[model samples]
Target chain A: MDSRVWDNRAWLFVVPVMAFVLFSSLIPMMTVVNYSFQDSMGQNSFFWNGPGWFQNLLDPTTAVGARFQGALLRNFAFSFTVLAIEIPLGIAVALCIPKSGWRVGAVLVAIALPLLIPYNVVGTIWQLFSRTDIGLLGVALGRSGVPFNVTQNAGSAWAVIVLMDVWHWTSMVALLCYAGLKAIPDAYYQAARIDGANRWSVFRNIELPKLRKVLVIAMLLRFMGSFMIYTEPFTVTGGGPGEDTSFLSIDLVKMALGQVDLGNAAAYSLVYNLITLTVCWMFFTYTTHADSKDVA
Target chain B: MLDRIGLKRGDEVHIADASLELHAGSMNVLLGPTLSGKTTLMRLMAGLDRPTSGRLVEDGRDVTGLGVKHRSVAMVYQQFVNYPTLSVYENIASPLRVQGLPKAEIESRVARAAKLMRLEPMLKRTPAQLSGGQQQRTALARALVKQAKLVLLDEPLANLDYKLREELREELPRIFAETGAILVYATTEPAEALLLRGSTATLREGRITQVGPSAALYREPGNLDAARVFSDPPLNELALTVSNGVAALADGSRLPGDGALGALPDGAATLGFRADAAAAAVAVGGDGRDPSHPAFPGTVAVTEISGSESFVHIATDAGLGTLVCLVEGVHAFEPGDRAEARLDLARAFAFGADGRRIAARPAAAPRREPVPA
Candidate 1:
């Protein structure tokens, strides 16, 4: 017989959160779903279109489809670029931070300052900082005659957006990595040292393995955050320079709010949500299952 | 051999006057409770931590500056710290692979170590996937595969369940017997030190008070601190004033002072003995009581029955603290029962006011009653 006592009343504590989720997320999500299947004009009039917008969005030949495809590729490139730079840089920064002393607190707070800044404020700071006429970096580069202009050159816009995003978010990854590194008991390192492991071997065998679960969290957060990046780029570049920096969220906002294309935006958003969910699911499944399979 | 004398950190001293020499092909157990600087001393030996004072000399060379990676040392921790992501084979092979060994050599060593640890069948498994014992075995196998000259175990089996602890405790000495390494094992339990049968060092408050053969240390703890560290339920202590060949209890009760007790100078002293050295019997007849042995009247406060032995804790009428008597069988003495505890004064040790052992104990005599297994 099972020895576990079944107590369902404990779930009463979760009812508030469940009700909040229903009101905050599920109802809106259902509304988006409802919008995806119907065509709407002005004056709240709606007509059933039977997935017309979805078909156009999914087909590469259609205008909406081609736009979605471009934005998706841009999102992928941006997410991958930032993650590749941020993860290693974060780890290196975390390693460089002193393990103990008066400086650790100061360094950690400084590292976390960028993370604490509001996204739009960060965007505005970068926008002003990168302006050719008055910005610190922009004037310096302009004086060097590199022909830097986020408005006129696609490369400049892309570089600035990537750099700005990196500056704002790499600390977050570093903080997570630092916390993960700190959580590892000193015994593992001591044992590794006694085992004659060199510097690289210690990192490869002990530190890296211990940091796996934390890295998973960092990767997922970075991936999803970068994939749907809107505020900073929108504030600085506004998806300018011939759509060089327009990510999924930026393009979706332009389509829904600027162009008033609700049908296409709703369909676009559902598929966008689906892709993010799918990637996260794959990551979650692969990592969590791989370790549990090889039991003795 | 390592010497750690007066280890100072800032203005405070840790491990003062704690010097020990660990010989090859022998197990040296550092017996101490928590925060006794056991780990710090082991770290100094392993070259993981440098002693603020004294030298850790190996083969007549000072290597205090060299880091642990440069030394031939292996340490197993209380928490089984096997690489969570690596397979058992890879985990065992870790140290070997780090030494730049060839593929064939690493393979052979890992195979042998795996078989010895009985982890051969689980070579494909990760530490997270193994049982606690198997995980610890993986850690031990990692230490074993390196063939290091010095092996330090910081309470390796402390985290295991009681049964697993027992099993590994029996298997550990056998595992180390074949190796000629200088093995240093740290534990808080006196029973474990005795069972391991090594030169045991008793540490208290960061200082080692005694170091001798395991049984010798138990029979003759040179100081009160060492004896207290070596006891499980703790060595019983009673203040005594010795004069005219008699020791006076606080309540004006008298105990016959003879042998080791009589040898002490006529002055204030304390008597210390193991639980087994004292016996609690019915106050009326006092069966099996020696005529010369004095009985201290006490009321039974509590009784604990292990499988083979029972410990009767009696609150003595005398002002001295409660005395615990080890009985061989389950007497089931109830609380509030009037009793008299007959202490074996012949075997008891007397300590001076400075907490130094004042009595010169007799040479080794076979124990009359074995401690509870």
Candidate 2:
């Protein structure tokens, strides 16, 4: 048997990317780590606090600790709600798209239009669109005799945020599922039909199973995006009528930039990053493991 | 009664005016070249596609507008299509489950199909874990479990390797025999059509050129296209002239037309014969000067030895083009070697200019000892 020659020359191609990432991500992350344990008093003066902020942040008796706890729970709730709404709705939309026709491209483009908009622009658009005096949705809801105000009510704020998120990002999930659906050979559908499978059976056995990989990726991306969401909610309802819709990312920005508590904010950022990474890794591991079990 | 079954997409016609009657409990082979509408015809029969203008009648009932879901048909595609995520057992039981059959009945049927396809060992594994042939067997088992009245196999073995193809080909007929369903198999390979040994419908350019028993179609093709479709190495066609009920070749050799000429006006015609009907030999010591067999003098162009038989291609000196002859065992005739190829007139076919066979020569009498010339 011939063994492969070990050549260090291949590392030459990867060095540039490594250097770029080192400056772009790793160094900034290290900065956050450095700031997490140190207290800063204006004018670049710093003193090592050594986990004092972490202790305060973990103790719910304090005001900052209570805010962090509330924000963390709200972030988990938001991510779960977004996933629950988007996955099934995206699948339904993908299934509704015509498999083959002159209009397939047109429909796909229409569904993907929202995803092309900037995240801040999406937030701004929904913000205006939900104004009670001028915006169509708010005006329509007002004239229809319903008490709907995202600016003042936490429930309505959450509803509008979830709706905006679904409108803006469900298309990504749908497009992924559509691509997965198209990759399935026509023979599979033909075989299902020949087997006397009904519409539900075909969707369950053929389409759903085929879309598993794409759905996993979609779920992971959506979860991470929603967990780290700031721009959209910050622009739409400014993190709520109170602290109701302020997710962990918004709370981190508030703690670091609003109150200038760099040490506590940095600690919160690390914890936030850790939770997101841990959840995403768990999702990836579970899906790939389940996929392997299917093959075995 | 499928009257004028045709499918046209925009300006191009896929299947045009093709009509067929598929009998139950009989295997029918759709023999054609690539893009010959064989798959289109199978799809129409399986209710996978609607014909532009035709009515499909089954057991005296018209099922023209019926979709595949309502039709009692099972199809095995060229690609072994199975639910990749489901185990072989689930794949085979899917159709039964869709029909809401009892668990016991579904299990028994799935087991039986698995046994028939020799897939019992791999039933617990998914398609991704199985080899190509095993995956195809799983697909076949799924189709078999349905036990539909019409079973359509659209070049199911075309994607398999030679050994796997041969193994599955041998088992398929036996598997379908027990179902007693009307089996319609489509293939582009003529050898496969012959191996299946079923009634064949030859397709050409979206048209049903001929339909008959496989052996009869092979021995006496209805037209030139059918003959070409049914031949492996292809038939040797030569332009010849007929005069006084005798077809004469360019080399001054004549074959007695007798009753085989079929009242043709003496004129130019085409004669075709298989490679096996002709024998090539080096003329030595007057060995090949047989009076009964017409001989053409030629130079050996190429020789191919394939196991038990050899194919000798000879270029005639009379500008009659090259003729291929299949001889038993090996012949030591290299290129440029002088040789004579004797044509067996009994197996020759005469065709008119319109590409329709005018006559088929009768099988020759049993060979007698060569008399002295």
The DockQ values of the predictions, listed in order, are 0.48, 0.41
Q: Each candidate: what lDDT? A: 0.85, 0.85
Name the regions of candidate 1 deviating beyond 4 angstroms. Answer: A1-23, A290-296, B242-246, B251-260, B285-292, B334-338, B361-373
For candidate 2, what is the recovered fraction of reference interface contacts? Answer: 0.73
lDDT of 2 at A274: 85
Query: Compared with the true structure, what per-residue lDDT tens digits does model 1 show for residues B212-298?
Result: 889878877899999899887778888877776677766666765455455667778888888888888878653675644667778
Judged by DockQ, which candidate is best?
Answer: 1
Q: Write the per-residue lDDT of candidate 2 for residues B1-373, one digit (tens) a residue.
A: 4667888888989888887787777788999999998888888888888888768898999998689888898889888798877888999998898889999999999989998888889889888889889989988888888889989899999999999999889889878878888888999998888888878889999988888888778877878888878876767878877777777776566653334545555787888888887898885535545444567779999999986888999898878899898889977889999987777767777787788888656656665533211
Please report, as a residue range, the 10-residue window in candidate 2 chain A with the lowest summed lDDT: A287-296
TM-scores for every candidate against the unseen true structure: 0.91, 0.85
**Docking level of model 1:** acceptable
